[model samples]
Target chain A: MLKVNDINVYYGNIHAIKGVSFEVNEGEIVTLIGANGAGKSTILKTISGLLRSTTGSIEFLGHNISNTPPHKIVSQSLAHVPEGRRIFLQMTVQENLEMGAFTQDGSKLRQDLDDVYKQFPRLNERQRQIAGTLSGGEQQMLAIGRALMSHPKLLMLDEPSMGLAPILVEQIFDIIKALRDNGTTILLVEQNAQMALSIADRAYVLETGKIILSGTGQDLIQSDEIRKAYLGG
Target chain B: MVFLSYLISGISLGSVYAMIALGYTMVYGIAKMLNFAHGDVIMVGGYVSLIAMTSWGLPVWAAVVVAMVACTVLGVVIEGLAYRPLRSAPSLAVLITAIGVSYFLQNSAQLIFSPNPKSYPVIINGSLSLFGGKLTISYISLVTFLVCVIIMIALTLFTSRSKMGKAMRAVSEDKGAAQLMGINVNRTISMTFAIGSALAAVAGVFLCSSYTTLMPTTGSMPGIKAFTAAVFGGIGSIPGAFLGGLLLGIIEAMAKAYISTNISNAIVFAVLIVVLLVRPAGLLGKYVPEKV
Candidate 1:
């Protein structure tokens, strides 16, 4: 489980995340849904140690990782797939996955690679191909697969479906659900409210760097205010 | 026969340049900074080796090891003290700092060793006759060329096949994402500097051996020339650096031999300018568009 308490983040003069607090329980898919600049990605970045919180703490599985460096945080078994699919473009697919397992011992690396390949068969097919040449959807899959290579305790995805087609988005969501069913905790951030709500166990609505509402996914989906404001009803 | 001799010597010189250029390219690739102090590291290596041989009475092999170890430590110290703090600073600031480090090394060498040039001991003596003595190849030239080739091949394999190598490539691509993958970016960078500086030391020994002279400023000319080679071959590409160094060396040799020795440096610069005009990314470099 991950616990984030009253975290404030800033980008120089601009206050990006204001007193945001949330929690992700074990064995559940928690999602943060908001429009552009809603501080969803900022919250994730803060938890992943890319950006420091001005106040409060982030506890991952009971360990305070608030001041830990980004690389050290990854060793704690938390994997973050950043907003953009920042895969190593010049490296081959297999090499990118190997990089993902940077903290693991050599003995587990082969098994982890096999597991990732099983999840994303396309990656297996293009193991030797350069990542830059991958299609957008394939790149997203590669990003997810790369994150999974670390055998993370909690997997955080930012905009995994941002640039994909609707069909591919559905496939990705299905994969996320499959990952959850297989015992991985996921904290997903997305602008796609409908798709996110359909799969999320619990969801938080964010607006202007604050959490405006929190409820079970089904309750938010059926709420008139949520439907009108976010669901395009 | 004269042409043959010139070609052989040209290749030998090219091999030396190629070794130094690899150092530049590898450091630039990982750290995204031009280590102007790299050339000065080579100068230090030559001094250390000389002292280890003459003053310490060490054997040739032990002296070479001493030079390499000294350069490697100096490189790591330089990174830790000078470059690490400026990781987040502007490129211009870092560039100026690197130049400062270069000047510091050169001045320090001058203070310690004095400004006079010193002769390096001959490690490889004698020559091999080829084509009935029409083409004579020095033992040092053969050794230099063989060593350069072996190092290049080993480096290529290490980068492609090793886990640390994968981490390095990842860090170069995206520092943030590489961290997300659990790679210690700082450590990878330190390794890169160590390897690069060690290579420079090797090149320095071979260079001093061939030229038979050592001074505080000896590394500057070769350093600048090797840098030109790196840019000409595509700044971050490994094979590109080797090709660039070899090409520059051959061109310089040909110009000095056939045309005029006085204008050889000018000719090398001309080739770099022409190559840049024709292919801005160099021969093996791919053009990367700036992302918004």
Candidate 2:
């Protein structure tokens, strides 16, 4: 389980995230849905310790990870696949996954790597190929696959579907659902509200850095305001 | 026969430059910043080794070990104190800070050891007679080439096979993504500095010993030349730096022998300029277009 307690984040004089809070229990897909610049990624970054939150704390499982460095956060079973898929462009696909298991003591990654390869055989096929040359969809799969290499208890994915094709987007969503079904907690941040809400156990709508609505997946999908504002109904 | 001697000597000199360029290229590769003070670390290593031998009465091997330890500590300290704070600052600011660190090290060396040139004792002696002594190879030159080759091979292995080495390569390619992978980026950068400084120590010893004159500024010209070699090879490419340094050394040695010693440096720079004009990215460098 993870908890974000009323955190506020700032960039210089500008307040980016204001009094935002949320929680995710074990074995659930909790998504934060919003348009561009709605502070969804900022909140995920804050929780992962990539960005500083001036006024609140983030607790992962039981430890207070508000002050933990991003690298330390991953060791505590929290993996963040950042925006743009940020895979090491010049490295081989296999090496990218190996880097994912860096904190897990490099030798113990055989089983973890096998599990990831089983999930995404495309990555396995291109194991020796450089990651940058991969297609947008393949890169997204590699990004998720790299995160999964860490054997995380809770995975935080920022914009997993961005720049992906519709068919590939569906595949990614299926993978997210499968991950959750396998008992891996996921906090997904997405602009694709329809796809995210379809798989999410619970969803939160953020606007201008504050949460505006919260409900179960089906409830939000059927909500007229949600359909109009996010689903484009 | 004269050309052969010059070529051999050029390779000998190039081994030192290649060694120094390893430090430059690796730090540039991983940290994404040019630590100009890297050259001064070589000077510090020279001084440490000099003191260990002349004042402390240590053997040449012990002196090398001592200098390596000293330079490694100094490299980590320099990264911690000078470069780490500028991690997020503009590259221009870091560049200026590096120049400042270079001047600081030079001046500190002058103050501590005096600016006068010191005579460096011969660490490697004797020469092999070949072609009835018409062609000769000094022990130092042979040792320099051998040591440089071993270091290069070792470093290549380190960055390729080891876990920390893999972390270093990942950090070099993408720092933020590397962090997300649970690698301590700062520690990796620090390790980069440490390894670079250790190589610098070896280079410093070989350089001073080969020239037989040690000064506060001994490392500067070679440092500049080694930096040039790094760029010539492609700034962040390891093999590029090695090949560049060797090429640069050969060219400088040839120019000095066939032409005039006074204009050898000018010729070296001229070649560098021409190479850059043709390749844009150093000999081995790849051009990455900036994303708008």
Candidate 3:
């Protein structure tokens, strides 16, 4: 489980995430749905240590890892798949996966690599292909596969569905569900409310850098405001 | 026979420039900072070697070892003290700092070593006749050529195969993402500067030996030439820098033989300009895809 308590993040003078707090339990897909500029990505970045919170605590598996450096955070069993599929474009797909496994050593890397390839067989087929040439869907799969290479306890995905075709988006959502079913805890930040609610166990609605709603995914999906604003009623 | 000798001589000199260029290219690839002080770092290496060999009465090898270690430490410290604080600042700020470091080093050397050109003790002063031409390749020149090639080979292997190298490449591609992956971005950047400075130090020592004279500003000409080589090869491409160095050296030699030495630098710059006009990115540097 991960607990983020009243975190404030600033970019220069602008307060990006204003005292936002959230919790994610074990083996659950928790989606943070928000509009553009709502600081959803900022929250995820702060938790992952790419951007530190001005004042707040992020406890991962009961360890106060708030001040830990970004790279060390991954070794602590938290993997952050960034907003853009920031794959090493020049690198082959296999090399990108190897990079994800940077924090681990010994035989554990081989096992984790095998597991990731098994989860995404498409990656196995094109393992030697340059990552930049991969389609949007394949790149997303590669990013997620890279994160899984770390054997991460909690996988934080920022907009995995971004820029994909409808079919690929559906496939991505399905993979997210399958990952949770296979016992990987996930924190998904998405603007696509309907698909997110359909798969997420718990969901929080964010508006203007604040969490406005939280409930079981099904309950939120059926809510009047959610149906009107996000679900296209 | 003279042409062959010239070509051999060109390649040897080219190799040295290429080695130093690798340092510039590597540091630029990761941090995107030009580190104008990089040249000064090499100059400092020459002085360090001078002091160790002449003042401290150390052996040639011992002098080199001490100079290299000192350069590495200085490189890392500059990265920490000067470049580190300006990380998030504009590239202009970093560029200014680099110039500041260069000036600081030059003046400090003037104060420490004085403005006189001191002869570096001849590590290898003898010459040999080869290929029917009366060629006198200095002992230090051969060593410089061999060392450059060896370092280039080792660097290629390290960047491709080692974990730290992979971390460096990752940072080059995307620093923010690399950090999220749990890489110590700042430390990696520092390591890059250290490696670059150390290589520059070796180049400085050999260069001084070839010229048999050390001045406070000896790094300028070679530094500019090496930077040109890096740009010619492709600013971020390793092998590109090597090819560019060799090409520049050969061209300079040909220009000196057939044309005027005064216009040699002008001709080289003109060639670089033409290359840029044709392909904005250097020969090996590919166009980075615009982030969506």
Over 4 Å off, model 2? none
Docking class of 3: medium
Ranking of all predicted structures according to TM-score, beginning with the best and ending with the worst: 2, 1, 3
Least lDDT summed over 10 consecutive residues: which range in candidate 3 chain A?
Answer: A106-115
Write candidate 3's Cα lDDT for A128-219 as tens digits: 99999899999999999988878888999999999999999999998988888889899999999898998889999998778899999999
The candidate that wins on DockQ is 1
User: For candidate 1, what's the TM-score of chain A, rounded to 2 decimals?
Assistant: 0.99
iRMS per model, in Å, is: 0.7, 0.8, 1.0
Error in Å for residue A179 of model 1: 0.4
B-chain TM-score of model 3: 0.95
**Tens digits of per-residue lDDT for model 2, A8-95:** 9998988999999889999999999988999999998898888999988898888899999989889899999999999988888988
After the best TM-score superposition of candidate 2, give how far the Cα of residue B134 lies from its true spot, in angstroms: 1.5
Worst lDDT 10-window in candidate 3 chain B: B129-138
Descending-lDDT candidate ranking = 2, 1, 3
Model 3, range B64-170, lDDT digits (tens) per residue?
88889999999999999999999989999999989998889889999998989988867775777565547666566678778877887888888888889988998
Native contacts kept (model 1)? 1.00
lDDT of 1 by residue, B52-117 (tens): 999999988888899999999999999999999999999999999999999999999999999999
Poorly placed runs, candidate 1 (over 4 Å) = none
